[model samples]
Target: MKTTLTSLVAALVLAGCASVGTVDPAQLPQAPAAYKAQSANGAAALTASWWQPFADPVLDDLVARAMAANTSVQAAANRLAQARAALGGAEASRLPQVGLAAGAGRSSTPGQPVPQPATQYNAGLSLAYELDLGGRLLHERNAAALDVLSREQLLADARLLVQANVARGYLALRALDAEREIVRGTVAAYGETLSLTEKRARAGDVADLDLARVRAELAANEAEALALDRRRLELETALAVLLGEPASNFRLAPTAWATALPAVPAGLPSELLQRRPDLAAARSQLQAAQARVGVAQAAWWPSLSLTAQGGGVSNELSNLLRSGAGTWGVGLLAALPIFDGGRREAGVNTAKAQLDGSAIAFREQFLLALKDVEDQLGALTLLQQQGEANARAVSAASQALKLSDTRYRNGLVSQLELLDARRSELANKRAALQVRSAQYQATVGLIRALGGGWSSDAGVKLAGV
Candidate 1:
């Protein structure tokens, strides 16, 4: 009987080892040439901490706050802890489980010691171990470890989001500041023009209609400037909210007009697949799901367990460990799932379906990421050209506006013509400012889509924030 049981346990163990399903490591997607934004390999210099490249102190401050205070980041950290705890728990199953028992009781038996009650005491240690013949525990451990990896990727994704948001918010604030300055200049110019028009009307040189028109234009410009200022304030408050700070406490200093756009690197699309944190998260999840298939398949096999216990029983407390009062036993158990209402089968199918779904999800994310990089790359290229052209237009308009004002002062141009020149100059400046802002933001977006700026080949690890 002993030999048969040992053979049965060994056979079951071997069967478990053979039952694991196979899963292939996913390959990176094809890199598209369209994803490249520049001719130089400058993007290769991108680090996960690419936000630091801007060297903006105010931006850095806001990023620090977002990293520390963002609820999403904290939540990812909690998930990592949970995964680590689960891994610890899964590992515990690899070792034997030990327990202790103790009892003292009084018992009476018929015709025993002239019907006297007898006192008894007992103590023992018990141990049980499930032989890992089916590798179920091993697969479970692997899955749990992968879960930990997935959580780590999630944390990275969270950091990326925080940094991107900070960059965008800072960019928006700066853009609004530029727009407000342009509007203010227009308001001041309109005020001067209105004053001149009123003086001419009083001297009977210009008609009242002309003066009324100039006053109306001045009021309109002032109103527009006020509206622009309100919008700027609202953007400031929104950015502050994202930093998890009171809006009043967060202040963004207005920056001068930015003339240059950051350079983007042209890298292979395949490289992007390895750079994105969300993609990494998806890959890790897929790996975990594949491992779960093995865990589930392991359930179809018999399980082997070994147990042993040794203890002493004695009527007298002092003789508990005496040779005559001591006893020991060892046993091995094999459990074959003969019937369980098809629950095991259902579990296996569920795990397989989940694995399939995970694979599909990974592919979908990869494709979407590729699309994002391509779209941003195209936008960055076009916005840079547009910014250059707009700058030239602004310079020409500035010269024209100066000539128009001089001509008007010398009585060579009408008040309506001066107003037209002023409006044209203001519109050109506003357009140029807007184009530059778009260029800045588009550069930031391309960098973000490329996975926080670092390639897979770089050994640099992006710290949180």
Candidate 2:
């Protein structure tokens, strides 16, 4: 019997060794060494606190609130907690289960040489453990662990998303504020023109047609300002939602758009794979799927378990632990499904299908990450050129407006010429502002694409990874 047991143990070990499922070491897609777009010179590393570089105090406060209270972020955290709990359960399953039990019963004999009431009491400790001969339990435990790591990465990704959104929204709002100021200045100038035109008409020094034109321009500028006001309200309310507050209760006082843009160097493309939490989560999920395949395949083999019980039994509770009342037993159990009508085969096939799906999804995510970085880098480079051109346009228009204003005051130019110059200046300035806003937004996009500047890749992993 001892020799048989030794041989069975050796068989179990060999079965376990042979049960490994195929999961290649993370052969994630490689990237070109350098980004295709022009890299920013002297760019600093992106950090977890990506928005802090903007140096906007209001933005800092808003991001802190969003991180703490945003519904999506909170939900992600809850999911992470659940994953950890599942991991704990899986880990516990790998260890022996021990429990204490106590029971009491009374019985009466009906017919015999003598009939009497009898009482029995028993107390004992019981233990059971799976030898994991087929490695099913081991794979289950590993799958759970990988799930936990995946959840952790998802949580980080959620935080990154929230911060990126807040930065973009706040920057856009400030740009709107800046644009509204420009419109307000234009309206003031138009009002002055209207008043002067009226006075000149009263003195019969200007035609009534010119006076009407001035009044029309003032009204048009006022309408533009009103339109900006409405747009600003929409943006403000949207931002309020991001902050996880009621729109009616949250307010951001208009401030100057002086937030500094951070320099973002397009690092090596492969580095993006390590830094992105979403990609990391995808990799973990793929690994977990591979583990599940192992678990499914394990079902084709036999399972071995050990169980033991130790206790004392006596007619009375006081004698339950008496020397002669001791009771003990142990069992070695093995089970192999004789037939399941192709159930095991179906399960293995299903798991492999899922593994295949996970691999494809991971590849898609990898491709998207690359696309995101390229899109933003190209945007930033192009936006810089646009900004430069718009700036020159604004400067030229301002100079033209000044010349027109002097000519009109000396009666060398008509009021029409002066009005045209002012219109040109206003249009150029607003265009410049739009380009600036794009630059800020694209910079934030690039930072998000780069995975909020994460550096660590430490976490739970599957075997042979």
Candidate 3:
């Protein structure tokens, strides 16, 4: 009766020895039904080639090159390979281990040596299998697998970020191109005006002050054109770095902006949460932490292993494998630490703390994902409205410039008035271009926030704790 009672208590102790973790994801906030931003039902769906929707063949090529050569993308892939290797090691540990041993030694009793030194030859095949009574191996393997998954998602995230950055940099560079064109065009027009003003002043048809003002305006516009070129060069150098090429030898020629601006459709919020690689990575890390916590707790329990050895020993090497000289043995090992200061408890506590940290990190990543999508959505919606308004402003300013120029030449308006009209026209045109550029960037941003691309069926199931 006492033996039965003791066995029951031991069984109970082992059953409750280990756990995944204390995190209850159910207690965390849930994903909303739909996004709180403007969305279209007729928008094109997302594809694996996220940048292709821009419709710029050049952008498509750049993204492909960066994916293949970008340093950050390469680094992430390397980390994933390492994690896979670790997972293989963990899996190997779950199987039986076999080893072969061989040795030859010479020995002699100081005064009792018969002929010479005695030679001993021994060889053995040994096998060991640990029974997962404490579930340590299982938890360790689980943790390693989760780590591999986490690495995969992290790699995805790295690629997504690089892709987004390239699109952003390229779009901004193109915007600069468009802006530079406008500045140069304005400068040329101002040059013509300055020439006419000089002629009028020499013929006594206009004041010298008017000619001086035109010259000042021409110089200022020329300076602005030069400034735009300098900015363009800076952008090109940075893009070269993104493509994993040295800035010194890399150059991106100013090309016509033919990229399409497709409206991003808002999909189900649940789908968004699942498709985000960063969120998936955070979830995998959290699950791995929970598995590690179980592994740490398992340290407090006894480990049971079965071992077997078959061998032969003989003074003559030739007879080492003979039946008469053969030997065999088997054993079952159970180990429980009597004492190790407070290390085991400390390890368990550390694991629990890590689990807690991972849970918080997962929640933070989830919330951030939502915020990112919302930010881009809001920006795109407002930019669309702003672009319409800017276009009207540019139109009005252009008309005002034409009137001012005609009146100034007809001697009905001052030179200052003409200059002011030119300034307003230039500013309004630049503002419109900036708005267009922002709309492109925000569209890309929205795509990235929606997990680098959109797909109706994209979903990632988080590992249960």
Could you give candidate 1's per-residue lDDT for residues 126-162 as a string of tens digits? 8999998668899999999989988998898888877
lDDT of 2 by residue, 46-161 (tens): 45577888888999999999987899999999999999999899889889999999999998889877878899999999999988766788899999999998899899889889
**Winner on lDDT (2 vs 3):** 3
Pairs of residues clashing in candidate 2:
none
Query: What TM-score, computed on C-alpha atoms, does each candidate reach?
Result: 0.87, 0.90, 0.94
User: Where is model 2 more than 4 Å wrong at Cα?
Assistant: 1-28, 205-208, 266-270, 454-465
In terms of lDDT, which candidate is strongest? 3
TM-score of 2: 0.90
Ranking by lDDT: 3, 2, 1
Q: How accurate locally, in lDDT, is each candidate?
A: 0.78, 0.83, 0.86
Clashes of 2: 0
RMSD of model 1 against the true structure? 4.4
Regions more than 4 Å wrong, model 1: 1-28, 33-44, 106-119, 255-261, 266-269, 454-465
Write down the RMSD of candidate 3 (Cα, Å): 2.6
Per-prediction backbone clash count: 4, 0, 0
